[model samples]
Target: MNFLTDELDYEECDKEINKNDINYFRNIWLAYDDFWHKNKYDKSKYKYVKTAPRSPNTKYGKINDFYRRCYLILETNEYYYPLDNYIKIKKRKRTLTNLEHIIIKNSGNGKRQSDVQDIVKNAKFSKTYMTNVMKNAVIGVEKIKEKKILLPNEKLFVNMDDCFISSLFNNKKQKNRIRTISANKGTDLEKSTKSRNVLKDKKITYMKTKNGERIKRQELIDKIYDFLDLQFIYNKSSLVFIGDGAPWIKTSAKKENIPYVIDRHHAFKALKKGFIFNRKVDNKKLTNAYNLFINGKYYLLLDFLKVNNIDEKIYKYFKNNKEGIINQKENWNQGVCAESDVSHLVKSLKGYGAKIYNDKVLNNLLLINSARINKLNLLL
Candidate 1:
């Protein structure tokens, strides 16, 4: 049994006590100390002996008035009961400190719950407790984000893309699901290519849904629209939706009556794929065709592709996404880096051969990752 206080240093106090009626005072003090020690360590003295609450009552009712024995654990692994009475009847409930919640939450970042258990030592939290802590932390951070008002910018660039990770379900079959990420800011391609830190400044939100289900996909789109609506409420800023010309993305923008811009990188990649087999079109002609597209000469570019016997699928791709094509000579759509953002945002979930078994855990992980990316303080 560890006592909360150190024993008295009798030798150090001997000189002071020697001056007056030493034997009489010493005997009295020794008797009192023995009685106090016996009372403190006697198990029968305290009726409620539990160190902490196993399951605290969270609901508001008359039952909550019952007394609960609990102890507080500090960051240094030191714990103590705030109340001296061990068996008093009261309504107190046991809960983790803010710092404890934060430590558990941060330790689990980019890590599995079991991994978090290993990282956090001397804590009474189990894997289930850690999961609940993370879930609650995410909910708290989300509430904070909801109250935040993004400052209006002259132009608000929106980028949306889907990232997929291996599903834990049917592992033998290796199924996949969609985790969509959307941001209010677009990365400058030139700068982003020079340094990856440019993405750190963007505010991102993520959604998880089934890969191919139409209803789920529509729900995701509606959620994204709601996010956008909230962000756009404070500003009359010009909005531009940038993506890789995915059908869902196009549909999302069209439904919202927003302008959509096909990423230039995807556009050029499509052109190269289309012309890969055409040996007749030399490098010079390829460069000329690229220039025609960049210069917004869509009709001439189509004629050039046809004359060069480019693949018809590429022609149709460009024809269908013609409106999304950013004209360097006219529009200022510098393209989007959605693919890279997806890889960066969901790296933890996709890395270390990680697999998510349920939507609840997956959504919690996504929210935690997004909160970390946005540099929101989960400790609050």
Candidate 2:
């Protein structure tokens, strides 16, 4: 198992030795290396040899380095041959230490397996090894317990959002959406949303196809609730769900009877998109309308829109999300930043779509990345 040697003492040598002489000796040693012979002997040598039952000595009786071969140690070129009889000849099981596994996991920060392998060149980390580590880490995460419980009558603010990433299966491109939930305790929505403190807990789940059939929306909802339950705040604490005005999100909120707040960013973006190219409304009017919305003047905003002859679609967009908009204006100063959160949580899945051909591994990667972002221990 030795992978190093002491420096040679040229001054004390009886005969002059140079690099060429060392190479010659190395070649000779390599040719007779017992470890290599025991592991790499030609099996064909015994193809024609017949042996009796319970024979004491067979033609090819040497034990093979099965563990090394199975674990990919044999594939590495950096192994150094130990001096003859320097150590006892015993079978050593090749295995990765916890630290080494952590290294492999860290090396996979948003990079493809090939790139990760290149980063950990000494280990020769294979796709199989990385996948197994991630799989195990995800399994370990399931055993984690939520120690923090919400106080009675406490209020919890939760943000839910979905981000899409491209998936390739059998060379056909598909789309997968990852849903994330971030929850924290706060009494004042505006102050809590504006604070820089990290959320107390965060989790991610994704919709992926199984057996060539996509998962049902109910299954996705169940997964989200499971995550919420794990946080120990499913129904105990007053929960407020905040997100962009997506139908699926609104439906989920309504199903749970949780109050939903439309994110200010999305509302403002809709307004800008509605009037960005309209020549009828000038910049002053647009600014005025935004101010009115931000100032909780919903009726005034509607009046301004109607008086300015803005598009009916723009008028309807505000009118429909009026309650959510007013809630944001009155309570949440910064509003929800689920879009930014999604970008951070799923950055690894983007731009590396082609490498992630398997849906299972992609989901596992999301779990691992989310755990890392939440500062959870990934070592298992």
Candidate 3:
């Protein structure tokens, strides 16, 4: 309490100290002291007072003596009659692996199954765990039908994506969060959170590694379309989704029947590229950037600038290309939430590089955005 209100609380305490008419300080001081030191204690802190640990026993006690006697008998190769009659524990107890962890995590199954292993592995666990993990990831599709996470009428305007993590086994394998592989990482979801939105409680829909490049664009669109049907919303004094102008993003809006705006990243890139091209540069690259933007080859926009050269200030580069920026105004406005959404995705799954054995696990990781949204919105 002193730390929070500083010494001021102490002064307040002293003001009421001594006389019973004035009020005793013990209750006031103890409560305040406890409040400030809540975290310094454990449990929920400040709400419930944790009992101080019970004093250790000075006597050996009955249970302790019983255990010692049993140990002595076992050491002497003498099995007690009652001890022998105690049922033995089973052999080969199944421990869940990383893949199993994901399957269970993703297993809501519209409440048909509470057992994770049931829907995930059909109740079998083995090396085939990796293969079935893929089957479970596909269960994410079923998950969308009745989102256990997203509240009714909640909209997911974001896209989820991840690169097929490249493998270390001669760089042949690709890892997803639920599916681990060879890639190290740049995947921390919060690391992906830019400094600007730091204080905001913004975990709207976004993709983590789902944007990476491993999952196909068509697959994303199909999932969105199918999920949107499950989420069929009739009105919007209640919900809205935001995302950038990725092609798949626009297509998802059409499929979901939910209103959305394409986020500004694509347009922003075009603006940056335009300035780079206008400024003096080698001829071949200049033509390529212009052609790429004009052709809606948006992904190429950033790479084009990088591969050619970018000596100008990023702001100036955008300013010089202001005309290019204007061209994307509608898209920029529509996709404004792209920054918030996708960046969050990157933050949550950033450090995890575990191999995903299947689609079920992959989709489980992708659902974090929805899970977070539901968690926050629980207040409403």
Candidate 4:
């Protein structure tokens, strides 16, 4: 009974002559006005449109398009690695990537194809194509495979760390993906006390897999190199790399032939472990000895009498032995550059109490650093 299979030869949907039909339409609309207002909104859709029995064709279309969109996300994101071309979608040149769009639309309120057809009764494209676009407009992993991952220049003062995440971990509340994090360090005394999600648009040098279980170490390096190649296409001196003196970073330094700075924070970490952590040294002696060495007054350290000085006195240390002077002079000034670096950068950031990298943590770092570097001209 609901079937209007044949094309309409009737007059237009006008109110003047077909007053009865118009009244009937009004009654139907009034019955469900609030329903459409609450759901995925389409202001133009009239309530006169009744929910008819589901059609096999409509169901088939929904199922097919859903699968197609899923395919688009899978195929496009993967296949379209290093996307060198601009995307024109629905008359807009957009950065809304294929996968991003798919994820965005499906995640929000939108019209279903079946209900839409009842209101419009006509369409710009075939029902199939429209359904396909709406259902699976998201780009796929395949497209991503074809896309070239972009790499921005090695911006200076860029914070760097690596992380692992997976849902398989036992932390039910946390393991939306289980993850571990580490900074670039020569001797990684401890993993980073930071979050995995904190670097999304920050650092401008890396990305995480949506799967959350995957990691990116060397991949970040490769992507950065590729990005550098592109920048070299424009200007040769756009960026620089900054991280602690880890072996991997040092290797990347050689490979990319980029300048490297041992992050001042990590430099202080070495001092904390070596000089600061030593139990044999007392604070007074250590401080005075260091000051003496800094002033190039290694011998005056005994006048400041301390544990090492006491040890020297027990052996008639001042009279019989004097290797301490030579030892302090050789090392104290030699590594001052590294220690001075720590005093500057580490103290500047107050690089302590690092936290786990969650969305909030990552966003803060990314946003703050971005504003500082690109706008304030604060961080290079």
Candidate 5:
């Protein structure tokens, strides 16, 4: 123990002490000590401890014997076993090629799945087979969902966003078929706990599916609650969701009794584009639209669009989300970046010319990529 703790000096020690080592000498002393005290030492106890070697060795040799004893103890689950009867368990065998290891490593590095097959050398397997193996490796690992609050009294800032997957190999006939991809990421209200800063350990979840039917607003709400429940992340009083001012999101927030805010980025982008698209004479309509949107007078803006013979789609959308948009106060810190999360986690599956529809495979890969990004055990 002294040597292990760097408290021992080698040169000053006697030759006899260096050869037999302290552990060996201590064991012999212990045996004699026990026999003298009890008049009959337990022989079984010595079986668990190493028998002194025929030839004396240095401390390193004694250390090996110590490790061997530890392994036996672990294998037998702390039960007494004869030294000769200890079994050495064989490791699970595998013959992974260079290509297989490379593929798995690439996925862990955020490489595109379609591009992974290109890195395989010798071309021993078909492209589809290689792709399947890579996907399977990802799916074989357990799903991960964990959260950590880094600071005391820190609130949870949650954000949700949506994307679409437009291509599926088997659904070629449906040219416009798209799967809705919804994602959510969260962090503590502590300034240092931003998503980018905590990329390796952020809270994230995803749900993507296509059934040709409009997803009910309640379904999305239920999913949000389910995700939080599965990850064991819940604190309604200290939780707030940031969304893109979608009617469904707002409605769901109301139902769940949680506060939500309009994403400033998306809101400003829509206001600018809609103002340009709905231009009026002398920039009159454009200026009014801008003023109303910035001031959160979405209902008045919709009326102005209607009276001026303009399509009310843009203003109507703003009106439906008036509660969230109007409640977006100046002090509210908005750091939800669900869109980028999709780009990082689902980029490979949704790459150009890549067709995917199997929710099982996509969901599995999503979990694996999420785990890898957070520096968790990929196989877990």
Candidate 6:
């Protein structure tokens, strides 16, 4: 057996030892002396006194603790999340939550749980224990459900998009099983883009379900509004939602009485798609649409659509978001988009060829990622 069991009477095997003495005991007891002592280390300050038989329990306890720490240090450095090895084997099944927290904390920083598992798999822990630790880690972000408000003078720039998780979709279900992914940045775009902390009041909402994506989407949007309500009520600061001209986003903004901006990238994309996909409009008309969009003449563009009978679904999208598109130029100068921010939060878990994430796991990963991006010390 690699570990000390109850076979030996600890009461009879006791000894008094110093720090280095404990290290030597651990090295010999764990059969690690040959490998450990071969490594070049300083030994000038060593006070090695081997006092025999004080208490076997004391000796076993100290050596076991040292053994655990040695194994933990092999996994990571001080910069990484601390490992949890304080639980006894008997109670480990119930007390491994601390280990789960450690894994989740590492995941928050973009490390996949699978990657974390591979790194520590050789340690004295069971695969099921590690799996449960990671599973709970992803679901654990729910504890942060309380609404968090924005600071004064801070505007929340929001965007919504779709992503796929392997666990949620199969070929028969939908080749591209899309889930709702939304992100918001609370700081100034220009200033933030130049710094590491590009997003100030960052929050990400991810919803995945085998079915009922629409219902979950609405719930996610409502959660955003609840957080906004706290800031809007007390600070009187308005929200500047930035999205790709999605109907749900438009509708939610209108209902909440909040102003929004159409992301310039998506606006251009919409125009191009409308012109190409929707019955081919003349090159002249396409040029005219681009001109109007750039000049912020959104109403005139709508009129052009009406007169020319260029009624594509994208056309309706443009009409619904006329204010947002116009606001992108006149009121909010420069291109304000959330594509980069949103991508950063979702790429690892829901990217191409990625493993399908469970609905709860996907949601939890988003929240954890957002907390990291926003520099919020979320509850693990």
Candidate 1: residue 320 Cα off by (Å) = 0.9
Scored against the true structure, residue 197 in model 6 reaches a CA lDDT of: 38
Q: Identify the candidate with maximal TM-score.
A: 2
Shift in Å, residue 193, candidate 6? 5.3
Query: What is the TM-score of each predicted model, taking all chains together?
Result: 0.59, 0.60, 0.33, 0.30, 0.55, 0.56
The lDDT ranking, best first, is 1, 2, 6, 5, 3, 4
Clash totals, every prediction? 0, 0, 47, 56, 1, 8
Window of ten residues with lowest summed lDDT in model 4: 62-71
lDDT of candidate 5 over 22-138, digit per residue (tens): 665445333433333254224444324434222222322222232222112444445332211211111221212333445555542355555564554323344565455544553
For candidate 5, what is the TM-score? 0.55
**Relative to the true structure, how large is the alpha-carbon lDDT of every model?**
0.54, 0.54, 0.36, 0.31, 0.49, 0.51
lDDT of 5 at 114: 52
Candidate 2 Cα misplacement greater than 4 A, ranges: 1-104, 107-142, 152-154, 186-197, 209-221, 233-237, 278-286, 308-314, 330-334, 351-357
Q: Which tens-of-lDDT digit does each residue in 1-380 have in candidate 4?
A: 11122221122323422565333422332233333235423324322222222111211021111100101123233322111111112222222233223222222112233433444332222444433343333221111112213235322222343433322223232322212111111211254245421221221223434444444547657666564443233232333344444455546555666544444344334323333433653565456544654343535644554443244323243222233233324321222122222222222222211222233323333323323322222111
Listed per candidate, the RMSD to the true structure in angstroms reads 12.6, 11.7, 18.1, 18.6, 12.8, 12.3
For residues 348-375, write the lDDT of model 2, one tens digit per residue: 5553324554555566666667776655
Off by over 4 Å in 1: 1-139, 145-153, 169-176, 179-181, 185-193, 196-201, 215-221, 229-237, 277-287, 326-329, 355-360
Per-residue lDDT value at 377 in model 6: 69
If the candidates were sorted by their TM-score against the true structure, best first, what order would they fall in?
2, 1, 6, 5, 3, 4
Relative to the true structure, candidate 2 reaches a TM of 0.60
* Worst 10 contiguous positions by lDDT, candidate 3: 54-63
Report the C-alpha displacement of residue 243, candidate 3, in angstroms: 5.4
Where's the lowest-lDDT run of ten residues in candidate 5? 84-93
- Global lDDT for candidate 6? 0.51
RMSD of 1: 12.6
